[model samples]
Target chain A: MGNDVSFFSNVLYMASNVQMIIAVLLGALGGVFVGFLPAFGSPTAVALLLPLTFLMPTDVSMVMLAGIYFGANFGGAIPAILVNTPGTPPAFITAIDGYPLAVKGKAKEALFVSNFSSFVGCILGAVMFYFLANVVGKAALAFGPAETFALMVLGLACVAGLSKGSIWRSIIALAFGVAITTIGIDPLTTVPRYTFGKIGLYSGIPFVPAMIGLFGISEAILLLQKGKMFEGDKVEEEKALNTKANGPTLLERAKMLPTNIISSIVGFVVGSIPGAGATVAGMMSWNLARQRSKTPEKFGKGAIEGVAASESANNAASAGALVPMLSLGIPGSSTTAVMLAALMMHDILPGPLLIVEQPGLISYLTASYIIGGLAAFIVFQLSIPLFEKLMYIAKPIIAGLVFVLAVSGTYFLRNSLTDIYIVALFGIIGYLMKHFDFPVAPTVLGLVLGGGLESNLRLALKIGGVGELFTPIASFCLLLALIMLVLPTIRSRRTRNEESQVM
Target chain B: MNRIVGLLIVIVSLAYTIGALKWSLWTEGNPGPGLFPVIIGIIALIAGVMCIVEGVIPVNGKQTLIQGLKWSAFLVALTVLVVFLMEFLGIAIGSGLAFAAVLTAGGYRRKFLLILIPIITTVSIYLVFGWWLHLPYVWIQ
Candidate 1:
């Protein structure tokens, strides 16, 4: 506790530096700018700027990047509330109630709740990050190969749970991703596996190219297919929704404090679990709030409580994501995984030893989140009218700008043509998957978890004296996977039977 | 399309499993190269079977196999085309062309998009990566 205070004081002192302040401000501003734009999220932003971080001190660079992350999270809600477009995956749920509110001529109120909830959620998450750092960090370090493998298995099973459509298709995508991961050298042995004698395959499929192809290019294709940049009806409605501001009064806002607190707590707990991110947090919190609301039916129609619940949950989830990243060195989402990559680039491994070795860094990071969150709140509050104007921009221009950014970002990663090709390929895949109603998130998760699962499984086998392959933990994970695979089918069958009976 | 995709995946999984089976499962010390892949391949094959069965059964309002084919074909063509272009033009040029073509084909308008997007993208790549960060343009090499 004493160490924490000293660390906090030291961070506050460091943050007072002019250079650090400027970096934070720039990062916060940049985060909001990128987050406001569709198809550009924090991960891409961080990846684009990662190389530049080499020029700054590691602590300052991390602080700035962290600021960008929090800023993006805050900025994502603006488009979601006013335009019905989620700037990030987590903001999708925000759009559910937020858009309705916008249509109901309460756009400002919805935006206010979103901004406030995000601020509250971020502070709550930072508090959790500060308190749990020592305990969670240690547990993360103690995980062996077997435990890590089991965790990956659990993550894959969670992906199965999150898959919205045909579970079989999701499993197939997961399998394909795993197969792609195996295309490189075997972890236990130096011998190559599925490289097909290609030198590039020896190192496995590079993640950046695959990610760019899947999300960025695929999204571009889909946007084109939709035939217009923005939906005409949505644009008309938004124009009408942009009426005079009649936001909540200070007392009215104060009355919702308890709800924000509860939602933040719920969001943090959900976010701490791997593969469970802001989307789930938002959905869960919104549902919980609805169930507890006096008028549940008002949720989808334009409920301030619904907006608050979703925003709080999503923001908290963003913070909660850091828990696993900091403690277990496991990323809770794609964005966090990218942050992990950035940390690795800096040679700063996050685990049990992180806090002990660099106590000040954790405090610094925590302080950055607080500062970033505050900065985001201030920026959003001041720039609501300006951001609202962005809705009028033509879709082609926005898409064009996004395309340029994605292209440049991919090129900067490795300058490899293969990477660009991979991005295009994935982009097409992402587009088609959307058309077919297959969830794209699981595919990303599968890709991210694939190498970890493979390497750890091999390592655990090597460590367990060969015959111990079927240890209790391994069996437990396999059993869990089996149950996850089977249970969904059974549940669907049961639901169908019940419906038939009712009919 | 659903049945074809399912079948294709199954075949791929089978092929991979066969290859994995041929490798030593274990040596004196290290785990064998095939150990994890073979298991994954087998599970994938099972999943493929489930997908094929589901495709044939037509539970709920799922798209018909033929409907799936159109999308699958378009995407596969796009991917192959992009890969081909990448070999000749390099990442930036290839990506810009691919992006413009794909977007336009998808129904995007504004002729200026093709010109403006590519140029801006290329220049940005040069400034941030080549000039600012000092990362080598490997594709150029």
Candidate 2:
């Protein structure tokens, strides 16, 4: 009863706060705009706008950042539908059906279904996030240092599935990320490990500048190679789906609801797993929906259900991606990793204790997410034609804007030019990694989690000797991590074998 | 290139482990700093070995390396230019040159855009970071 009263009181406080409302409104607006631009996915978008949050209170900052993340997920579908170019990986699937629908003069139907699906997905994701994060957080109260160490190991093990090239190389990348984070003065001992006596290396590396480099500057490098991204858009003249009453009424589309529900659940589940982001969730949900559809032939050919499936799953996945980050201090996606960085910067550490330590902040964040989603729906659904003009904006212009944001955001952190240099160095590293089909996400995750991982391991080891490694909970968690790493490779091999046999 | 990367990883990991050897492994019941590094270094070594083996036995076609080298080079040069600007000149020149250099690298050759946009970008950064956030980024000082 006391908890309920406090929770409602917090809600009432947030509801009356004008600044919080404004922050959400501004974040949603910025999210839609930045998300529509080229090479600015959710991570880059968050990293770019992160500086704005630096000046605001932590609650307001989180509200704005949450708004940006949610709005970006919805905004990416606009470009996917309009220009066959997805602003982010998750939206790429939306293009398969959405662009075709647009070409068939039913763009409005595709867009509407997509937004509706996204709304449903966001609602479902929020529900899952609230319940699951709370449950996970509570369960984690039973965890000791050994269990926490195992959890970090499990988090690192998930990097294998995220690798675009060789899993081995990704492991190397993860190790390298951990190694770099272990630089500067040791937390246990005052002795420096890899600082090599440079006073500049005192703080090791700032996650913000590293984030700007990995996501922001690397994006600029990728954009530099592609010439004229918007030039290929085949714009067509079509009437609005709203004006055309002959088409499926909102009620008729409501009949096609099973796929959307399934996709949302799938998305939420996939997104809850560390390292399995929205893109995979969208793709898997889309394929599953198609497999179950009566008119499988209609897929990839302007099917409204396809739009419903992918959009629902992707948006839910985006929301669900927050679960691991908030509950276990393990970021489920790149955007969440950056969000974790933002939280840490503001002296708010998210983990099992977050529920008890900062329940009011959590309540505000959860409310902001819902409010942000609604804002995205109203913004994107009501103003499709307005955002269509964004498709005509030149790629170079977007590149220029992002470039400015990158340098400014990096430099202003602690007012150090050294941050900019760090951005440059990591930018080059990110470029090479992307160029060679290596994954950058794992490294960032490793770096962010490395400090906690190190301390936890040391604590567990100190309390108990080498025997501590064999604790029941720790061993169980390690086995789960091993299974998570091995299962995907085994499945892939089996699929390959089946394909070869069929051939 | 893949072989070289794998070799580099192995070398780096080995060197790291060797350097960690100087630190005390364990003190009484407390685990020293070296223990964690040594364990991580071993994992790194295994990963490196795996990468090297994967590089040695390849079945698929190789993708081209040095993708769009010229553009990447120009972008790097532009970043360096900003570093020089910040050191020699001030924030105005640094940010303006950086923005201008980025535009040029992105194939923005329009005279007005090249000249005007950078100034706008620099000014916006100045007003926001310096004025609004109240950071100490002096434009001319």
- In Å, residue B58's CA in model 1 sits off its true spot by 6.9
Residue lDDT tens for model 2, B24-125:
888887988788788889989998898787673232223223444555566667777776676566565577777776677566778997898878877776
Interface RMSD of 1: 4.8
**Per-model TM-score on C-alpha atoms:** 0.72, 0.69
lDDT of each: 0.69, 0.71
TM-score of chain B of 1: 0.57
Residue range A359-434, candidate 1, lDDT tens digits:
7667767877787787777777888878666545554444444455555455555656566556656766776666
* Top TM-score hit: 1
Which candidate tops lDDT?
A: 2
Q: Chain A vs. true chain A, TM-score per candidate? A: 0.71, 0.62
Q: What is the lDDT of residue A153 in candidate 2?
A: 79
DockQ of 2: 0.42
